[model samples]
Target: MDDARRTAAAPPAGPGTGPGTGPSVGLDIGGTKTLAVLLDAAGEVVAQARLATERGPQGVVAGAARAVRGVTRQAGLTPADLGGVGVGVPGLVDPGPGTVRHAVNVGVDGAPLHLSRLLGAELGGLPVGVENDLNVAALGAAHLALAEDGPGEGDAAGVDLAFLALGTGLAAGLVLDGRLRRGVGGAAGEIGHVPVDPAGPLCPCGQRGCLELYASGTAVAALWPARTGRPAPVELFEAAAAGAPGAAEARDRYASAVAAAVRMLVLAVDVPAVVLGGGVAQLGEPLLVAVRDALARESAGSGFLSSLHLPERVRLAPGRVPVGAVGAAVVGRRAARPAPAAGDPRPAVDHQPA
Candidate 1:
């Protein structure tokens, strides 16, 4: 039940004008922890907080509500001052009804949990939006890509980026021509479950040789102990770096699997950039270099693959910020905006490459 809070002073700004005019809160709910960030109108983070996630649907909602309140209080604001709250859940979500269809890692599954309504109630009916965590994290990563490269806001218009998260599990967030693409069933970017080996380890999703079993942090941590008598994935990496027997080969296989995933994404969607993220992405440049080297090997053997220049397209999520939380904040801010009428002309889809 312990919680931690941190605050930072925002530059002088006047009170927000309406539901979509003020600061917003973004919460990233993971299997092990929940992170909340308060972002002002211009997207600068004003305060942040973290807490252990509670088990079950109701506990998850309560923990999130507490996180929101704690961060706002730290920032010297209140729910009334917020534009809205956005949450990124690590599971299936039907955003239309603000329901979480399943989030097994957090103990929610089989039944729809009305997450937004519960969160709104906690915030005195302030607007709330819930979406797949990877999707929003992709949004945040795309925004960072745009900011790093040039001037336009990273909304669905200016950035075409793919975010590959290598966390406890693996998945992707796709931002194409400025829009987040959640396929028909909201499962467009579930790349981790893509079958890669006919006889690989079994995935919780009832498949063998899924990519996550080989590339995710969970997978690496699990495999390292069995193969090298190591207790942690980090130690395995360290051992590999020191040229320990069998470690380098294992590391290479993991990297190759990840590279294969990236190649599949680029070949299918033609995105210009792939941003590597998630907890495992903390491996940073070494991981990126391994992926790059693997891609290079593949491309050297196939001209078609080389034509895509996959190596140059890969980038790491920016190391300086909490991208998932900031992205959830962005989603929350957008949710607070008035929806466009049915007959209104929608923004034209951008066709530019990432």
Candidate 2:
């Protein structure tokens, strides 16, 4: 919006066929796997690739480089044809230097991994930007939102939304006025650690009754462990549908806790949308319906809450896209482009969900 970020109204001549004028590559590096996407100049994901993530500093860099090449090649391009590369990984990241630390999931710790520089070198010095995994997911979600709804008239800032990830642990990624909010200490959108009940069970963060303990995927597993080796969320929902005793109640309780998370984000940031993502979200419509219902029920008695349309604000992340990888591609595009003045346009894909 201000610096190192600008969206194009129209794409270049071809799918990033020239230096600094072609498609960009984005990588979402997780502990188990690395997902990659090739975002063409038209803002569409032209190709994608997935690879087993090699751990440790060396493996991460090499794996990321390989992912970039694989995705680009899938698009019939090469690293040289890419505008830039973007990486999203778990842990603390200083985007300025493209360095990451405390990324335990990727085996990076203590010493900062100069991921951008290292990966850039591996790929012939192409510009590479590194960002926190959650932040990139938020970016990717925002990109999709803008694609669905074109930029508002006279509104320099684009979409306003929060990406709530109910994975193993609960957390959120904030994209306010079309910009990623990393917060001062990079703790923005960490609503999972917020304590709700003073007398509840203790959390790993030393808080009692933290929101995560109630709302996360792990919480669902605890509430209804897999009796048939299927995921707990699926089993719980199926059982509830079949009138399993207490399953319905447990499901509703979990939904209410997630609804609380949505409420907190809307109250704090008042983002117009809250994209439900992460593992539990894989349950799709069931999960979305449950959370929306909980929001409606919890706000029933409060006129103030009803006026906010909190339930309407909740939606599932697009099932068709690898959001994290797409967001990383956006980062890569930003790295390749010059910073436009504040309020400049940003990328928006033209393709609809396939």
Candidate 3:
């Protein structure tokens, strides 16, 4: 099997399943769809389900509850048979209270939606934790990395990496030293708004020539609209492969920008890996190669950059699995575990910036 296929089938890692803990369920709740997964104790995805997401506070809770039930049922189990559920949502999330606000796409407005409390109540009191969508994806990527090259020695929490999402927008999710780094105000990975061109077009975030303008999937669409009405990235890559007009240049420019994002992550946090994710990552190997080539060019002139091994650290996110959902399962499993006693040898989350 190819590497992508193998990575897809590889089992994830989390705390072992013990008495009274069957499996964990995770949900990646988007504006249009809710993707759910049932992860067994061994970290293999046993069952999965996708359902149309209903809008509003009550709809969000109801949809999430139904998705959890549906996925668990597909595995011939009920919520009672599961350990816990974790939810990933896009918005300003106060994980402490499991509340989300400003999730306009999901029809959630300024009023904080009590997602965890409501979803848990809907699930007959199953433990539920809600987190930012990108953070869960980062966590999911870190969990998946256990089967990659294996974690570093003395690293017990999990792999340390960055999950760079190249979807409609360009942002990243960071897993530093086996813990999610949400930053102090939960804006840790908002790299898209970082202005790289002072004279470039104005961005909605009030920046000119923001990195998202050059790197995101939306940028591809704006750069090269598909005449065939397919995804712009698909069309652009196909055209470039066919040696069509100006396609390769556009592709390289996009890849170069993406490489910049990778450089930013590695240079700042010095993560060992940067997993390419989000919608555009569906381009697969071609996207990987392009970014690697760009990184090669970037490092060729600077021994300092070369020492970081940027290209070697880049990899595509697992293709077949819902990475965000798998991460939600990891979160759920961790939430169900009891706090460690005093003087436990395990490491706490290091909040100091790198």
Q: Whose lDDT is greatest here?
A: 2
Single out the weakest 10-residue window by summed lDDT for candidate 1. 345-354
In candidate 2, list every pair of residues with a backbone clash.
4-339, 7-345, 7-346, 16-22, 16-23
Worst 10 residues of 3 by lDDT: 1-10
Give candidate 3 misplaced runs (Cα > 4 Å). 1-20, 149-154, 341-354
Candidate 2 residue-wise lDDT, 1-354, digit = tens: 111111122223254554446688888999998888878876677777778898999999988988877777666677888888999999889999999999999899989999999999999989998888988998898888877765342232556889999899999999877678878888999999999999999999998999999999999998998999998999999999899999999999999999999999999999999999998999999989999999999889999999999999999999886899899988888787666568856532111111
Structural similarity to truth (TM-score) of each candidate: 0.88, 0.90, 0.90
Question: If the candidates were sorted by their lDDT against the true structure, best first, what order would they fall in?
Answer: 2, 3, 1
For model 3 the local lDDT of residue 28 reads: 92
Comparing candidate 1 with candidate 2, which one achieves the higher TM-score?
A: 2
Estimate the overall C-alpha local distance difference test score of candidate 1.
Answer: 0.80
- C-alpha lDDT of candidate 3 relative to the true structure: 0.82
Runs of candidate 1 exceeding 4 Å displacement: 7-14, 150-156, 199-202, 226-231, 343-354
